[model samples]
Target chain A: EAAVTQSPRNKVTVTGGNVTLSCRQTNSHNYMYWYRQDTGHGLRLIHYSYGAGNLQIGDVPDGYKATRTTQEDFFLLLELASPSQTSLYFCASSDAGLANTGQLYFGEGSKLTVL
Target chain B: GDQVEQSPSALSLHEGTGSALRCNFTTTMRAVQWFRKNSRGSLINLFYLASGTKENGRLKSAFDSKERYSTLHIRDAQLEDSGTYFCAAATGGYKVVFGSGTRLLVSP
Candidate 1:
């Protein structure tokens, strides 16, 4: 089965603190994505990478930065955390194609609390 | 502008009953995916449809590219089936836009 794992399943941080959430996938997929889920709203994309060393901004990328150090690892970084940034983060991976023939395999998600 | 809209916002079903969840897309979508989020905050992929309908176990989903919509039908509703269901549409791009989600509650 395709596996995507995220570290620090839960975290609590105070305002202005720096936070980093890590994600690793064993599926060797070419595409990886980071999303934040909030109540009453759909999952909003934060960042995505097509391959190692290639990072792309998504819809809601204002307060977030991402790094794709290796094919298996994608990390989301929050330089200065704020209470509004608290959310459940999910990591997903997909095959080569854009979505025509590929399906996204998601991780268990990391719950972050910014106080 | 929202690309996807799912309805109804919330639903309640009795055991042994069944219903359908629909998603409407504002633009042309290349494909659609359905997911069910468990109470533990894990999202389980229920269906991925490029076009037409696909069924597994007691769940069925259909995607109509021409109409820009998708639907998920649940049969023999059970307590375990209660959760938030979301439909995401791929707009021929790298990103997939998701709906607001449907919160379902099934009681005995």
Candidate 2:
């Protein structure tokens, strides 16, 4: 099984504040993703990276920025945060190939509150 | 519009009973993955199906790409099984969509 860890299990910030959520995976997977879960919305992808120095926009990439410093590290940055950005954020890693059938290993999630 | 729709948004079951959760995709998905969110809010991977069925302990999952649907069956429910179950589908090589999730409450 792959191991994924997230920092700052909980966070609180005021509107227009800056926040960053970090994730590290030990599996050396090439694909990393950032998603936010909210009531009635399930999980919405914010950003993803195929490898270091590579990035891709996802379903809900607005108000978010991400960087894949290395294969094991991915960061999601929320600049000028708003109340709508308050939710549970999760980071995941996958090793899917051309078929894209691989399962994702997820972190424990980080809860952020915007005041 | 590509979407994953899950049924029975919430469910309650008694210990020793069983139930099934279903996810239907609006478009052709390459694969489907099932996850369970534990009490502490950690999402645990349950199963990943590309075409057929797979079982682990009291949990079983099946994916029928032709029908654009997948099913997760839980047998002999236990208190530890109470949480939210989410199904996500992989499509267009890189796009993954998640369902609204089904919250299960197992009571003694």
TM-score of predicted chain A against the true chain A, for each candidate: 0.97, 0.95
Q: Write the per-residue lDDT of candidate 2 for residues B1-108, one digit (tens) a residue.
A: 689999889999999999999999998888888999998889999988888999999999999998999999999999999999999887757678899999999999
Q: What TM-score does each model's chain B reach against the true chain B?
A: 0.97, 0.98
lDDT of 1 by residue, A1-115 (tens): 6899998899999999999999999988999999999988888999999999999999999999999999999999999999999999999999843356779888999999999
TM-score winner: 1
What TM-score would each prediction reach against the true structure? 0.97, 0.96
Q: List the residue pairs that clash in candidate 1.
A: none
Model 2 chain B poorest ten-residue lDDT run: B88-97
Give the distance in Å from residue A10's predicted Cα in candidate 2 to where it truly belongs. Answer: 0.9
Give a tens-digit lDDT track for model 1, residues B8-101: 9999999999999999999888888999999989989999888999999999999998998999999999999999999988877587899989
In CAPRI terms, model 2 is classed as: medium
Q: TM-score for the second chain in candidate 2?
A: 0.98
Which segments of candidate 2 are over 4 A away from where they belong? A97-99
Q: Any runs in candidate 1 off by more than 4 Å, and if so which?
A: none
TM-score of chain B of 1: 0.97
